[model samples]
Target: MLIGYARVSTLEQNEDLQVDALKAAGCDRWYVDHASGAKASRPQLDKMFELLREGDVLVVWKLDRLGRSVQNLIELINRLHKMGVGFKSLTEQMDTTTPGGTLVFNVYASMAQFERDLIRERTNAGLRAARERGRVGGRPSKLTHDDEVMIRQLYESRTVTVRQIADRFSVSRGTIYRAIEAGGVAQTEN
Candidate 1:
């Protein structure tokens, strides 16, 4: 069975072109999405993945329609391969079911990996440069040490609820829980 997957970045885009192409390529059935490929969560994609079985080939109108990044593409292909399924890109004219197609796909996967490595190297170098210049990255903490200490005191003393503390600090309940876990203290004294 040739299972098709199609997508458009926004609701304004039409699926007719991709659907037509997939139908022309002999797709027996399809899953379509009206969302960005950058989004990790897609209901139709997840549904299609669950419906796929061994010997079925997953087809897409284009590579970008199926994947947003090399790492993500390779990961999905690896999963499909493990399930004894094949992958095909109509525009790229590449398939993983044949030896020649498999070679080409392998080359593509390698190039994606190389691109990913280059990105990582660049990011690391930028971080190192920032460190040398006495700068740090990452978001600033939402709560101060005193706020955490007060949170611990309030919780242990049963004076305030987790929700109350989170609201007061403008953080989530999970942050308070993590702080308590990391601090390893149940109470505090003034």
Candidate 2:
């Protein structure tokens, strides 16, 4: 059984072309969605998943209609393969039921992985360069050095509770604790 799935990014867009293609491909049943591929939720796509069986082949008008990205496409295809099902894309002429199709899909998967690795490497290198220039990432500290010293003094005096100190500093109890710890370390170093 060839079960088809089609999608349009907006309600204004028509899925007639996709429907016609699926019908030509001899789809036994079909589902359609009017949501963007980037969306995580698609009611019709979920419904199609429920209807798919082990021997069923999931057919789509185009590969982009099925997934938002190459990684997403590979994941969906891999899932279908694991369920003992097959996949076919009309526009790309990709069919996972054949050896040649499987090879092509594997190459696509490898390319996606290579792209991801390159992105990670570039990001790490950028961070390293920033650090070398004395630039740190993450949110700036909410409390000042004077505030930390005052928090430490108030904490050691035992005249006020940690919660009271936190309220006075407009920070969390954990922040107050860290400030006290930092002040203690600074004093020891001095």
For model 2, which pairs clash? none
Tell me, by lDDT, which candidate is best: 2
lDDT of 2 by residue, 1-190 (tens): 9999999999999999999999999998999999999987799998888778899999999999999998888989998999889999989889999999999889989999999999999999999999999999978999998898888888877788888989998999888878988777332211
Q: In model 2, where do residues sit more than 4 Å from their true spots?
A: 141-190
Model 1: weakest 10-residue lDDT segment is: 181-190
TM-score of each: 0.75, 0.78
lDDT of 2: 0.90
How much does each candidate deviate from the true structure in C-alpha RMSD? 3.8, 4.9
In the range 54-165, model 1's lDDT, one tens digit per residue, is 9999999998898877778888888999999999999999899999989998998899888889999999999999999999898888888888788777777777777887
